[model samples]
Target: MLRGPRRPLWLCLCLCLLLLLLLPGAPGHRGDAGPRNKKAGSGRPWPAFQGLQERLRAAGALSRRYWALFSCRVWPENCEEDEEALAGTLGLKSDLSVRLHGQHLAGELILRTVRGYLELPRPDKALVLSFHGWSGTGKNFVARMLAENLYRDGLRSDCVKVFIATFHFPHPKFVDLYKERLTGQIRETQERCRQTLFIFDEAEKLHPELLEALRPHLGRQAPENYKAQSLRTIFLFLSNLGSNIINEEVLNLLKAGWLREEITLEHLEPRLQAQIVESTDSAFGHSCLVKENLIDFFVPFLPLEYRHVRLCARDAFLSQELLYTEEALDEIAKMMVYVPKEEQLFSSQGCKSISQRINYFLP
Candidate 1:
């Protein structure tokens, strides 16, 4: 027998218990799922965190990203497909753009602005586009197309923020409150990623003070950092204020027997800006953004003719991945009621109701 100093009998027993607890298949041993299994052991209750982890992984958040790290070996094909979707949408003309029907000017201007933005080392002013036209004339639609092409996740990305005048800031009396909130939102958004795009819809109804608040964000000339930040950010103004004026001009030209091509941006800009001043109660033309020549472009969406409406119906149908024929497209277009019975010239509602109109044709 070895004559070693004997430890306490209780101490020896405690050491054995600890070793057993640490071992696999030991009486008290359990792995990471130990807590999970314990709940299941009694009534087989599921763990919330485990299920959530699965969903996040499926949505390509956690595990998917980790998996993407090794995607070159696992799934290289997906990387090639739509790999440059974001850039492609911006740099090239999309299919929907080709189907823009009567909106060549708007499309060309969008492409020009995008091309110019990409070229600028540091843009002095943000791409401040005021999309002016009647409802469903593709004002919001073009803005959407631009947003989708600019960012991968399209409008869903946090970089894109859309504020509708009626819904987001309905009260004019709270102009100061709205101004502060709007300023804070932009400042916070720009902090995260200066490549932020703010789309203010129904801008015609925005409060004068609120629109004035955007002036600094657009044209800050001092500090290089401020100018750089503003350069990366884009502000899109969507409104229906100048629709009637645009319509009238178009009709007058057509009545005078002038070709559509003759009706140019040169003629429309002054007319639209003048109408914005007369019709819009907000700071549209009155704000420093306008007076200072800060608005980079004023894109007008003109009234859609029958063919244009048909193209819209086609686009809407195709978007839903639905099949259709010329007849169906024509039928939907015909259902649309145009104004001024004499000419029956253009769709009164624009393509705004295409989603609803398509339902009639859909099985």
Candidate 2:
């Protein structure tokens, strides 16, 4: 009571000021500490409507009904059986056991991922555009496999939707026009969906210029206001083409003084004085590989020779009525052997020994 109270307010203020001056920044403060982590609100920020799935199911049902109606109206004989089969395939019933066997899981994964991204909110800004190769349709069986996976993964066609479009490039005359039209269509799709996951199934079908035009968009980069929207678009060029074709095209461009050499068979195999159509007409030739830049392509899980043997076996089975029993396949596989041409082999020594050779045959 006799002594005056010694307040430490001034000392505390002085200490705070000193600390502020000495410290890099205040705790939890981002001053001069790089970008701030603006945390977005957690939770699925998209519509949780199930109508899309219901609509898809309904559409499937309706299609079945339409088929029944049409069959009954026109040919009435097998309409009931057809309707039942369609219903079973379309999973009309809740407990319908529908099994889809896919040849390639990677392709399925790519397609499913794209579909999932599209199902997210405001998909109009995003898209998954797929490309098909020679004699391939946009609705190829593999593409349908992807679509089926997406559908199974709860991506109802009516929900937060993105367009899955497939484009083809068979002729050169339509290359530029196709690119222009595709670019415009993509932009328009983006404007509507706001997000897109572009998928190119047979990317090799695209003209080099068209591919270059789309290269920037094929990656993970988003345009704007959609940074969080990761566009997992992919370009799967199931071709046998390799970098050699690209090199040849480059050389031709350099020699011709053309600003850009369109990648084609003419540029790649200049020795052959045939049209592009003629060059690609060989049945056994590696057109798929050459056109798709698949040179040096190797399947890590299986040896190249074995893969080729399997492919050959499959092809044989498809073309002819050969029953490929497991034992038979194994036997044929053992007999298959890869014989590298002189020019194709990297080194002469590399092909001297059977063990050293890279085989494309089964044996």
Candidate 3:
């Protein structure tokens, strides 16, 4: 007994406290909470405990996972939350179909392009999607839909970065500085995340030099050592550059008796490319990106119609759990101004303010 060394007082005290926490019916034990505690129940873990187990299992945290199990054993109600789960094509499709309106082409094209690219075992280049449309026509909405479905945190994810032209780089003299920062940020983000998304809002306002700097990232060659699906990236360019052209083309299609669903990429892509090339006044239109054909798809968001606006209003009301009438829906739709003087076909503001508009009906 003289040969044995004494245990440290603090270590012994900590062990005793841990033992107390695990003992059922002991003071400060997990069972003290109630019958729902794992220690008190009939060998059944809480529903949240089961969820924790499943998530830990999927994450393949074999070694450290026991800590979670042990923690859950002591306190079932306080399991840690896992990172967000990424959605597949079906989930993306369902969200876009349910939440988005009046842009059949945008929904279908975005779904196909994104899903297909994500499935590729080894993509040679980043998936560059250029979204063109008038203000309030779901360009930003579709971008958000893609973000929400692709990453767990959506736009808020550390892997996702958004750059606005007018806001981020308003001065022409600062083009060099913006290009350096932009390129550096892209490289840094890609290095940090296996899959990354970069969104350029008001892309048309981006400096030509800045867009040129992005050419290397969007090119057909992948970054060195970035092979297969180990590194995946998607670049979204949202702009109003070709909105007028999109509106005119859509109107022509409607006048030709073609249904909205019948409109195809063949009808829009070529024209969009041509417009971008012809637009020498804007940085986006004159950028080497357009000339190089680096953009994989130019997704067009069609101007929303009255029916679409009404649908948006209905959704807005339901979202707040507020009761609404057909009259209310009509009133909301009518409140929006339609353009093209004669036919008055589409909502100029799209569904931009429908959520706020519902406030009027809140009693």
Which candidate comes out best when scored by lDDT?
3
Instruction: Assess candidate 2 and give its TM-score to the true structure.
Output: 0.31
- Residues 247-278 of candidate 2 have per-residue lDDT tens digits of 34344454576533133333434332122324
lDDT on C-alpha atoms for all candidate structures: 0.67, 0.34, 0.72
- Which residue runs does candidate 2 get wrong by more than 4 Å? 1-148, 151-167, 188-205, 219-232, 243-303, 307-324, 330-337, 341-363
Residue range 1-363, candidate 3, lDDT tens digits: 001123444544544454444446655334221112122234544423422222222222212222333444355566432211122344467667666788889999898888788777667889999999888888888888777656657788888899998999999998888888998899888877778889999898887788889987888874565553326789999988888888899999999999988998888877877887788668787777777888888898888898889778876765665656666778888999998999999888888899998888777
Q: Write the per-residue lDDT of candidate 1 for residues 154-184, one digit (tens) a residue.
A: 7787778899999999887887888888899
Query: Worst ten-residue run, lDDT, model 1?
Result: 53-62
Please report the TM-score between candidate 3 and the true structure. Answer: 0.74
In the order shown, the candidates' Cα RMSDs to the true structure are 19.8, 26.0, 14.8
The candidate, 1 or 3, that scores higher on TM-score is 3
Which 10 successive residues of model 3 have the least lDDT summed?
31-40
Q: Estimate each model's TM-score.
A: 0.72, 0.31, 0.74
lDDT of 1 at 29: 41
